[model samples]
Target: MHGSAASVGPAAADTPSRGTLDELDLALVNALQMAPRAPWAQLARPLGVDAATLSRRWARLRASGEAWITCHAAPSQVAHGALALIEVSCVPQAREALADRLARHPQAMSVELVAGSCDLLLTVATATKSSMTAYVLALGRDEAVTATRTHLVQHLYQDGSEWRMDSLSRDQRRDLAEAEDSAARTAAAILAPEDRALMFALAQDGRRSIASIAAELDRPESTVRRLLHSLLHGGRAVLRVDTAHVHSGWRSSATIWMSVPPAQLVSAGDELSRLRSTRMAASVSSEANLLSVVWLHTLDDLARYEAQAAARITSVRVLNRAVNLRWIKRMGRLLADDGRSTGFVPIDLWAPVA
Candidate 1:
């Protein structure tokens, strides 16, 4: 499964620094990223660690909020709605409160306090264009929000679900991919309301046991298991383990907007998604429609990566770029000031607006 992590509140003064992740810890995280719910035995052999050791390490990581796994509506589900990236310029003093307010909204998938032209950036999903427009208009009326710009996503080539920790060996990744393919082909069913409820529960904790979900939903264990299988294999839901970028050797992230011919859009998006630095790649409704976010070891790496990308994807022209200074919330999870996950708020992207 694959989902994004969230953030909330400022980091405590004693918050641990990013340098704490050791080599083994990084490898374990990469393994989980490849297969979020892979059995401990399945993951242990490749990492050269015992199953028990893997489990204990993972438990520690989850408890410390340095890492976590959660489920999200798959790309297919997100495509059923109107998805947009909103740039908000808010009054300096009200930025924090405004972020908190936006973070609580079910439609706001991500709320970040960023640098550059806008003070905040939000990725929102609404059921329709009209609803999306209404949300934007409402934001424009907020006294704290001085201005806003919305870019509707036309196509998402690569989202958080596609990002991987490249720490694993080629053979290891190949092995994991085969297992995932096997699981993916096991079921194909349309999602129902109860399935959505299961999704919400999984979103809160991807590692939640089958028994727990069954108990909470008041359903038979076998039924819940079957539904979970359908949701996973049918691609209705995905699970992702999120961690601080700093811990992954990526200290900075930049959003790049590109302009490409309509004919080359898909090819260009595909090429961008193949890049190691890309976190997200999509075609949006704007002059610069090809939007991508890339991680870098430092701000200086942005120019180098951009030049390389421009050369490789000759059909796409670079338009503009912005840096994300701090992420206030990501994927419905509240983050601490230092980018560690502190809590979660289940993303109800399709929740009705009244």
Candidate 2:
């Protein structure tokens, strides 16, 4: 499924004030993480907060860009296509400019300035193999890019959509999970032209009022409402919140490559997905069959995790890893120098490369 986009803006004059998340804030975030479109009253009942208070707090979070929800095409829609993690080596001085340019491109789902073998890392999506080849060729020809390496994703085990803050009580989580399970029972259908338009609108803001979307599409409100409900509940689209990791106290992130026995791949991936640190995990078409993006409270945790993973998951072997030095763009939201989300560039995963 899809998420938020990066926006371009001037750097902040000072670091945005860091506000700590109290217990209620964490619970609210965890609840929304489970069901991004859950009505405030439903959320409030479990959290023991009034619907009005919950609504007000959510507004504040969105306004501050600390957290907000957006929509993306479901995995079934994208699995037939190509997704690649691109390692870009560019002129040191041109890194920022190049990252900004890639962040603005509709196909780039994420771009990061990193301390690895490459200067920038990009997660790119394209609808077909030819399009993917063309996009990679275009990047290779760019004057600023000196070299590039791309690893095609084969099987995604756990995407960011499955990552959670784990701040809710077990009973609270069970209730939310039940609601989601019920909604997911509907069968998914192919997207029509109008459905695509609605998805584009929601990609900008998952919580956008149905009336506004109907007006934009020039369709009756009832029609728009029905289409949206079908898309979400039918598993045609994924709605998720993109939050600032700094605010959530997750200050470090890493990308890992691993080798796994073919017979053990599924079991290993399933086990890795359950770890609290995993943000994204998948099998790729390379010497390394498994790749994972993990979040940590500190840089030191990476070594500890690698050691523990090797010791515990005997079927999987760690091959290589890189820490994300800075995020140029996450989901679709561009990060300012201070790491606050400034603007959005909608992720159009199925669009042809220009």
- The lDDT leader among the candidates is 1
- The sequence of per-residue lDDT tens digits that candidate 2 reaches over residues 186-235 is 34365566767888898857878988988888999999988888887787
lDDT of each: 0.79, 0.78
* TM-score of each predicted structure versus truth: 0.91, 0.91
Model 2 TM-score on a 0 to 1 scale: 0.91
The digit string of per-residue lDDT tens for model 1 on 162-191 reads 687777788877766744422342223445
Question: What's the true lDDT of residue 332 in model 2?
Answer: 78
How far off is residue 113 in model 1, in Å? Answer: 1.6
